[model samples]
Target chain A: MPDTLFKPRMNADIKRRSYYSKFIFNSHFLIFLTIAGGVFLYSLLGLLQTLESSIWLDMIAALLMSMLLLPGYRSLLKPADGIFLLPYETRMDAYFKDAGRYSLMLGISKVITGAVVALLILTVGHDTFVISLFLLLSLLHYIANFHINKRAINTQISRIGMTPVLFIVNILSLMLVLQHPAWLVLSLILLFAMGKYVKRREHRYLDWNAYIEHEEVQLNRYYRNVSMFTNVSHLEKQFKRRKYLDPLLWKPKGASFNKEKMYEFLFYRTFARDHDLPMIILRLIILFGIIMVWMGNIYLSVVIGLFGIYVIVLQMSQIYSAQAYLLWPKVWPVDRTFIQRSYVTYSHKSVFVISLIFGIIFAAIHPALFYIAVVFPVWGYLTNRIFSRTVYKKEQELSD
Target chain B: MVLQIEHLTGGYSKTPVIHDVSLNINKGEIVGLIGLNGAGKSTTIKHILGLLRPHSGEIRVDGITIGENAEDYRRHLAYIPETPVLYEELTLKEHIQMTAMAYGIGEETALERAGDLLKIFRLDTKINMFPTHFSKGMKQKVMLVCAFLARPDLYIIDEPFLGLDPLGIDSLIDLMVEERNGGRSILMSTHILATAEKYCDRFAIIDNGKMVAEGSLDALRDEFNMHGASLDEVYLKITGGGIDNA
Candidate 1:
């Protein structure tokens, strides 16, 4: 029965991805991806042309490839399975074997991608034989490493402690293999020893609770990544108490704190304490700023500024979508229209702030075109005005 | 009447879970919406709260229908659900503040009332903590604190005694009586008849998504021809009689 469950679960996961992929790869995101990828490739090729053959290239390739090792273990196991499947633990070997095969396929795809990315720089000094040997060894190590990760979850081993140890070993193994094909034997031996360590520490039964929590974390990480491109209705929002920012957060005074402005207050708090929204905005500004400065093109900066506002405004819409669907809002004494109006008020201000960051970056890039800064905030306000209505339309449809 | 539900027939979908469920609560009354599991207790309450639209009839609070003026209608009532639903990002204190803001209460007055309720529920020290991470009972107390802070004309509480400890239930019953004495009304739904019988001024018993009986304990006993029967016995008799009749 457990083995029969795995196929449907994997198919459902794939179907969910396919559903979200439509919105994630929509025209806006595709355009952004094209320009961003083009710029990154251009810069990388330019930098590579300036470099000569050296250990730094080998170290860089090794580091990047090592980072991709230890691919995540996704069992697709839910929290309730711990209770429901506990009595059937003795018959779970086939179920787990299927899960191992699924996870290995996922890890191998990443290993192939890493090898392709590393090959760009690895070709400088190393011949084809040396590179092939190192890549082959890395793939083998990853297969071994994934089993260690899976077994560690079943044992009393601390996962956090095991990660860095494996990471360093991965880096060392690759570097050694790059130096000589003979070192592949040493890498295999090390991998064997680690497997023995986990086998020795294995629990009598599976740790259902730990694996379930691990799966949830991986699921949330996937949602968080997808949320950057489009709203994820199923995302489990994580909040942080940034107490130091409370002084900066506006306090509603006198008349402004009434029923009409209640949602406005919540909207602001939602944006501020969200574990990702604030940081995502900051990271985008810095990243786009670096690219604009490096390219030093006036037209591109304009395009970048406007597009940054558009992306951040799209992100801000998630905050409204999050709040509107909550139970309290449906039951609150405030009028239903207050939320849309409050969202408009909150989002316009938020977008303006984000636009200001873009504008400032643009101004610093092109000091001669300081007046162009005005267009960014104005464009941000207009984008929010038009975009938030579509969100309200969607929310209204859901509620109706 | 503080609340009047007349011939309400509604459900989550086209099919109605509740059938012509008529009920009423006058000022200063504590009415127990008594029912078994899946007996439309929650559906009736949802209709009263305007969460689910009635398929046929109307629900009124303070003589105002939700369609006529939703803000005015909702302003008169506050709801505490069976399971505590909290803003994951907001602190306990902020929850009360949100209720006050939504109800248009002054900040100082809201906090003043919240302080008394918090002390009664023994949640004053945890006011700064996020109620989302609270234990089940404590989270229920946070719901209570938020609802009571609004001081609305009607309080719609669903299974108020489910998650509470004995002391917490005592505090809740005391608060309900206090609110009743102050001329406010409460409509609480629960299957725990023993707890309901102690404090409720009246009872509305629903069985199989229908209002099987409604009245005072004496009126119920007289109607059912069970003299001096306990509420649990009377409820079982009413609901069980339906099973036999079918």
Candidate 2:
């Protein structure tokens, strides 16, 4: 709570960042950034010369500003703070204030880049006053969006949903402001609505666990993004926090939150977070959907749907396989059969969702055969049941 | 008796690492399973936990053999390994919740007990944080919190103090004592002989894949003929030499 508490922590964090920054901002990254930035700037300037004032430019400006304006809140809070800082939690607001300042300072380059892009493109249509007003509205939206996001960390609210809605609101507001200065009132109202929606809950105290988990997720994201540019040691846990899909995850209540259903709990998380499974499954659906749409032949669509269901069902087995061998299942007092049952439960809903997507894709390709789209889910359920049986057999053999 | 092992001999492979190792822990007792490296302490613990099939003997918890009723056998026992083994995906709170679920404890009751244990170990607030990123000591504390939260009859702890700080060690000792007072049992395998001598009610010494001597401190001293000797001294004398003890 003391002003001094965060200073040393910030310095240490800076040092740690500097350590990884060298790896991230290596010669290769600089080269990539320069060439990519140069090409993008050149193309934009060239477009500006030929382009006229139009709504398309306004749309682009709105979209770009909205996309980049959500500079994520970073508190730099560690897991230990949940314990070590509890006595001082009431007074830790000063520390978080420091963290907010640092985060904004850290995000200045991103905000500026967004502004520059907006300014560069807005020059296509608008005069100085409107452009200035648009920028001012965007900056206000950015600040509001950032604070709301920070507040969401301490509540049970869905942060994932807030982000996309923020994106849409930013785009809507920026476009309205650009349309006419009088519309800025609507933009301001939209921003206030978002703020009210986000901060609806009252957090009596800091949710240290939430804050720390959020921090770790952010840190992992930084490392994960940087790892694409260069190898980083901190990216070992490939858990992509798919917070959006979490609503579908089993929210066990008092009665259902027992040993009989622990695996069901784990199965949902493993499918969503661990191993690139969800993304991979989503990609498979999209890829097969594309193929089905491309080859509009009804027969080909059915074939793609069958194979897609088969592949996705097979993919669902991986989470079960990974969990079966973990130490806790063996140690936990529950029967191993419960794990297989949980797998079936997980495969049931997840495969159905994937199959439904494929079905829609099929329906898009063949409108008259909508009834046949039902076969995809049936086929998916059958394959999953069979695959789950195979897993049980394999697990039985291993145990035997 | 909470855990009854009769001449249990087992290892990962067909060849036994612990041979004819017999140990019994009574209700309300804290028994230390003392041994050197490669001295079959973990093998014995594993056999008791039903993780390894004994080549020669059998183990029972709460008068139930694993084959008779595996879940019931496991339900009565909790094992904390030398190195903390945790789920990479589950958060600390989930681990405790999973423990409660596995033990058939009511969700609210398990959480209430876990809250008390977590507070004792200074981990109540970090419950939602993942253990994967925790330091070794913090992870060990999580293991302790989960194990104690279960309130099982017999706790099998292998090198329980390996990664624990002094405060953590003290908290664990206090919890063990409290659990014992509540008529539960603990089978702890620790290298910290001094602490074990001071706290553990009984001592079981294993050397060369066999339990050589086991009893109370004075009882073990009588068997080893080392009157007034410290536990380290008695342990060395039983295991035969510092070379193998190290």
Candidate 3:
């Protein structure tokens, strides 16, 4: 019965993968990949041209090998599995075996990709035997690292504890790879024995909560990545208060305000407290500012300024739907139009401030960009007006 | 009547989950909406709260329909959903303050009511704590506090007893009774039939999106031809042994 239960869950995961793949293969994602691929190829070519020694190449290979060793087990276990399937714990060997095999395959593919990249970088004027030995040793390191991660999970080791262990293993693997090949095989066998021992130990307890939590973290990571390109409705939001930014929300103490003013304060606080939105906006502004300063091109600065505003507006618009799930806001005595107006006002103010900062930075960088600075506030106001009438209107309609 | 729903037919989509459901709550009346899951008790309440529009009939609070004036209609009622829906970003104190502001309650009145309700719910100490730090029952208490602080003419509570400790449950009942005696009406949906029987002035039993039986305990007993039947027994019989097909 437990084995049968695995089939539906596996099928659901497959369906999720297929749905995500469809989105990943969409035109926007494909275009992004094409551009990224071009940049990567250009950089790789530049690195190959600057190749100084085999030892430097080996160091890079060691770093890439360590990154590939990071452990991730995608069991797709849900919280309810702990309760609903507790009775069938003894019979869950086949289920776990299948899950382990799936994860192992994924880990192997990643290692293979890393090895291929390493080979491409190391192959120039290098011995075929040395390159083969390097590939073989890296594979062994991957297997050992994967098993160590499994043991860590079974033992409930914190990631902080696992990090030094990973570092030690990576150093050892690099040393062994740089030495005789026989040591690599011996280390691989030792790792395998340790893995078998840990596997046996873990079989004694279900540890359903830990496995479910791991799977949820893994799923959230995938969802978060996918959501950057397109909307993923089922993705759960993770929030942080960002206490260091508390001064940004400074207001006069004991200030009395009406409901509309209170709403404006709430909107500001919501943006400040969100874990990702504020950071994303700040990062974009900084990145664009750096580019403007470096290039000192007024045209590029204006474009970057507009792009910054666009990005800020796009992310800030999420505030409209932020409180949509709560019944209190919807059922409150405040008019719905008031809420809409508050959102619009908040968006306009945020965009205006961001644009003003960008404009000042650009003006400071290149005096010729002073006109761009003056134009940004007006542009921000107009963009926000249009956004509230159009995009915001559509969002309201869709939510309704 | 504080709340009046006349032949309401509404649900998530065009196909109604609740059909022709009609109920009314007079001033100071505590009406229990009793049913198994998916018996449309929540749907009826949703229609009353104006969260869901009725397919055909009209729902009026203080004789004003939601379509006629949404803000006025919402101002007259306070709703506690089956599950707590708190603002993740807001602290407990902020939630109450925001609720008060939204309801147009004066600052002094809001502070007094908030202080009393927080003390009663035993959440005064966690006043500055965020909802993320709260336990399930603590979150429910926060919702209860916010609702009570609103001081609306009608209270729409769904599954209010869930996740509440025995003491918390007793406090909730005490509050409901106090509100009723203050001439505020309540329409509560619950599966805890015994408690509902004790507190409710009338009971409305629904099954399969329609009303199966309704009235006071004596009236329900007389209607079902089971003299002195308890609310739970009456409910089980009406919902066909309460199998919870939903």
Candidate 1 lands at a TM-score of 0.95
Instruction: Give the whole-model CA lDDT for all candidates, comma-separated.
Output: 0.88, 0.82, 0.77
Q: Model 2 misses residue A390 by how many Å?
A: 1.5
Task: Tell me, by DockQ, which candidate is best.
Answer: 1
lDDT of 3 at A128: 83
Question: Candidate 3 lDDT (Cα, whole model)?
Answer: 0.77
Where model 3 places Cα greater than 4 Å from the true spot, the runs are A1-11, A21-33, A54-58, A83-97, A104-129, A175-201, A241-247, A250-264, A275-319, A337-339, A348-400, B13-15, B106-108, B212-246
Q: Please provide, for model 2 over A1-400, each residue's C-alpha lDDT reduced to its tens digit, 9 standing for 90 to 100.
A: 5567788878987887788789667774476457546656876798799999999989988998888778777788778777888888777768889989887777777778888988999998799999999888878987888888888887888878878888988888888888889999888788787678767783887788898999888887776555433334455445654556657777567778776688898888876787555666787788778867865678767877787787677667767877887777887778898998888887898889888989888887788888899999999999889888887888789876
B-chain TM-score for every candidate: 0.97, 0.96, 0.97
Candidate order by decreasing DockQ? 1, 3, 2
Q: Residue A126 in candidate 2 has what lDDT?
A: 91
Candidate 2 regions exceeding 4 Å error are: A1-237, A241-248, B244-246
Chain B TM-score of model 3, please? 0.97
Which stretch of 10 consecutive residues in model 2 chain B shows the poorest summed lDDT? B237-246
How well is each residue in B65-134 modelled by candidate 1, as lDDT tens digits?
9999988999999999999999887778778888999999999999999999999999989988888888
Writing each residue's lDDT as its tens digit, candidate 3 over A104-201 gives: 77567777778777777776546788778777766666766666665556665575766666666675666566555666766666567656655665
Report the CA-based lDDT of candidate 1 relative to the real structure.
0.88
Candidate with the greatest TM-score versus the true structure: 1
B46-129 per-residue lDDT for model 3 (tens digits): 788777877888899999998899889999989898888877777787787788788877666777898998898888888767
lDDT score for residue A96 of model 3: 79
